[model samples]
Target chain A: MEPPDDAIPDRPARETLAHLRARIAPAEAASGPVLPLGAPPLDQRLPGGGLALGAPHEIAPEDVGDEAAALGFLLALLARRLAEGPGEALLVLAPGHPLPYGHGLLALGLDPGRLLFLEAGDDVEVFRALEAALQAGSLPAVAGLVAEGLPLVAGRRLQRAGAGTLLLILRPAGAGRPNGAATRWRIAAAPAARDGAANPRPRWRARLERCRNGRTGDWLMEWDGGAHRFDLPHGLAGRAPAAGGTPA
Target chain B: MPVALAAAGPGGLRLTAVDAGARALGLRPGEPLGRVRARVGSPLRILPAEPAADAAALERLCLWAQRYTPRVAPFGPGEDAFGLHLDVTGACHLHGGEAGLLDDLERRLAAGGIPARLALADTPGAAYALARFGAAARSHVPPGGTAAALAELPVAALRCDAATVIALKRLGLKRIGALARAPRAPLARRFGAALMMRLDQALGLRPEPLAPIPETARYGAARSFLDPVSRQETIVAVARALMGQIAPRLAAHGLGALALRLSLHRVDGAVKALDLGLASPGRCPDRVAGLLRLRLDRLGAALDAGFGFESIRLDVTAADRMPEAQGMLGAGPAEDGIADGTAALAEALGQRLGRPLLRLGGVASHLPERADRILPWRPGTGPAWSPAPLPPRPVLLLARSEPAEEVLALAPEGPPRRFRWRARLHRVAHAEGPERIAAEWWRADGPARDYYAVECEAGRRLWLYRSGPHAAERPAAWFVHGVFA
Candidate 1:
């Protein structure tokens, strides 16, 4: 059912170049600034990846740490984002899970000023808020903690609602089965690095099992507290391919 | 009109409705306004309630109180009235004793033109009672002596409202100590358990825990000067002093904060707080201060330097404890910190451009571009925060969707050669079509769309579509929607 020969799109004219330029220019121009992914390997796998300004991505459940660790991850991310520039804020939608709100976010780096909190008594309100935030573009990111095996259609609807918006759906990790998603990552607290390694850095094991743009693969990222950066495992670049082989 | 700001000092903000002429007419504290108004006539001025101003005032007070402890909480909202919670468990001894802290709070409050009652007790409830009811020298209640200390305060000090006080008075239970000796069953039956709980909390007979607040941040530091200092250099210097303490803690924990909070306590008892965030978590003092300047500007008027600020504290509500293990750093190799820099810049810009204006375009498997979300930078990371595919995608998306002008086609469900958008006729130069996307049946009246990717003479491609009624109904019609590059 290919189009008839006469209907085939002609090789685009140079004049088309002007149009292409006009189209591509804004995408590039709108690029006010991009926050780095804090991890090089993770950044390479993304489309202009880095922490997309005004765009947020989700950190999966497995990516969450032990109660305390998850709290730390959330706070650090929030603090980092807030510190990035003005109008940056942290919004948390905690559903099902009992988030010790006072302990978790406050301890992490939530500024009483930049933080807007909504405690959804149930999943419905949480989802509604997620949709509202996306449509309203009120906040840069919205985090929703959902039950495992939730329907994919609903997830798609939320994604559609947040078109250009980053929605993080926190679900239990390794539940082992596909729940439609553009990109899925798993993170865990790596064992402390062997002592005596020259100025050993703190690291976390992250596996980018799924991505919308391309495959990001498994990575061991070390976070440098003072410098505030995440570096990949040594010599691993030689082993791991940078991008997805084909859109999996 | 001058705004008279009054706070409970070490407690919280409390409002006393005062009129210019009504005071002369003999309206007294605790006197019902209606009765006074009837006596004073229509000429008496009525003061409107100002919760926003009150909350703002309390926010300032909390900044000042932070000098005494880190976890200073305002009492009226979730706790008791006109009081604040200072978890001085380990900090009191530094002030010499609980008595000293109380005395210091009183002196500071008076110096700020706010007269305050003082109290120090084993529990929050007891302290609340002592602060409200204990006279000058009678403020401190030693451990295990809560009952004896609360024995003289009236039932009203139990934090009950006027109605409840009247009920207690009618029942001959005028004193909190008297209520404590009464039978528990009758007390619960008459006033419900609240009265009993307050009594028990005051006596330390029940465990009354303070609800801790979560800030989603880590590693914060603050400093309070004995005298208010208005100089920007002084504020930055204090911020540096605090950051110096916070930096090592962050490094030791292998964590960094994305946000920093700077609170300035003015000498007039007015408090102001400024928040700064980083694009990434790093311990750079210069970077933190740079971001804070934006927030300071937002507080322009309310942030009056006054005589100057008496204190400043920086707090980190979020942090990460990484297992130290470094590797090489490069553009793509060190992704974590790189984006952090941009995030910092965005945070600063967000303040000026207005936060909602910043947005990232995420991929959505739907026709409507508006359905896609625009998110802020600092929300939590959850599942589905990333993009996922369901079907047809437009390369160029219009900021706002416009209706299609025509739906003529070569085949029944094919792409159109020409269409009008926003009242302009666009001759199709090339086209792709019939990417069918059925509406979710489980959803409420969702529409089914058969989308087309059409490139017009202008070389602009669009994601236009025809919306059909549910399969249960006859087929539907078309519309021009998103744009594609």
Candidate 2:
């Protein structure tokens, strides 16, 4: 039946509606599922209440010297992902990148036995291994340390291949290029809350710079190495960013 | 110009081998090189003899001759005679007949620029004598004709030593026919049982077994092309087809391939080989083909398909027993598929990169570097990962410690308050104790290290260590060993 002209949307309008629906679909249906970061404020701000599984995410240090901080954040996420499932995790180390200390990984709650490391000669090989690992969909998570940002096409390929898996791309700061990632984070080392504690937990100023179908915000996060979880500083929890952060 | 290989003997240099050009000029092997130079009024090319290289080449030829017959052995237990003996009893039928096999062998050897004298007889001794002393370059003795075949050959054709040959010549037994007719008891007593045994072996009275070279791989498949192929797709397809041929053989033996070697025989005799290792034993043709494709893609120009490849061979270099798959009654297939998928991915990546995927393991070592090890990843093979009650460790460890510059410490051997690393200055805001770790006395690696966990004002944490105590000759040096998040 013929309806009013306004009611019968035009071609461009229909396309726009479809695109909006694509963005609003449940993350579980679009990807696989959501992995809650276990932080209430952060989860409340995220669209799916957590990081989406089976999608690509980009993480980098805010400064060149803070690479260890970025790697620590990635390891925290990897440890959580491995704990959630029974499969192994693959870590592809690019050329010139140092090997992750076994004791350090153990101290951070990531089992060294559950991780496989592939040291690639260059960025090309690094991407090749990353794509292969993602496509296999055998591991629960896969991460690669790249010297520079990946091209858009390669990032999209990784995104497509990483269905039902967590794909993390770790690169140096200031090498950011446009990519098809679910979330983009920049981590920087932050001062410990306690001045003279015997062993202070690592603190990172994690900023969610970009997210698809969600909002972005900056927050000071602390990693509990003993428990392998992210935590808000004792007194700063109330001052953390709320769920009303600017939407992307 | 004539050429000869000379070796330093007891008195002087003597010719070990002479080419046809030198042989025609009456310069035979075992002649003194000085005498030959003084006698021959022409330019001569003399080079040192390489017996080792000759033996290696002969062994390779023996392996190469396996294409014609599996039973191929190098001529041995005698003087260094550069030749091979092949027993093509039942294998000759595959190449049409004995004549056809010899023709094919001769053609291939000549194509490879190898000058060969060929003969086919009933026994190894008969074949050896006929090939070395026969009038024709190629000879074929009919069945039941071994005695007649050796009748006209010289006594030396029996492969006897020089002394025995000279002694036989003095006894008027120059021909094998004359030796066979001589009184057996007297001949045996004079030349010992060895001479009589050689005659009997040649005449087929005694059985002689040929010890062929051992096959390196039990299962292999090979194909030759009329036109050399340089395209990657063709090579992959051929590899897949060859895998298909080998898969059944592996399954029949309840075995799976752990490693495979692909040899591409180029037109110029240079073989380009690619080796592939699997995370677990596997015999899937598609998986193998996929790995080959990945490797070929990575090789790209490095493969150097110079002038193309004429023959390709796939060999199962390593194999292991593969138990039959028994799926659980209620378990989902997806569970099993995941493990298979991971193995397939590892194989692909490892083959393409020419490296194995490794897993981090811990050793019972006090030294940090020695405490951690990386080994090839295998299922259920490494020690279980358990957190130890140890001091804080850094996430990233440098391959080697780099010295810190402009180090300023509060105490003589305490943590540094300020230091420059990689041109970046860091001011220590807080610090931990100096964990004294002595070197292993047995190893005598170096001086003991006093490690510290230092936090900079900028919030960057670094692991620093002092090499040794302050000394007059060698001052205590500080180096950054790792970085903490």
Q: Pick the candidate with the highest lDDT.
A: 2
Interface RMSD of 2: 1.8
The CAPRI classification for model 2 reads as: medium
- Computed on C-alphas against the true complex, the DockQ of each candidate is 0.02, 0.52
| Candidate 2 clashes between residue pairs 3 or more apart in a chain or in different chains | none
Q: TM-scores for all candidates? A: 0.37, 0.67
Candidate 2: RMSD to truth: 16.5
Runs in model 2 with CA error above 4 Å? A1-31, A193-199, A238-248, B1-79, B82-217, B224-234, B265-272, B300-311, B327-339, B471-475
| Tens digits of lDDT, candidate 1, B200-264 | 87787888776534352346666766666897767776787788788877777677766666777
What DockQ results for candidate 2?
A: 0.52
**Error of model 1, residue A24, in angstroms:** 35
Q: What's the residue-level lDDT of B407 in candidate 2?
A: 92
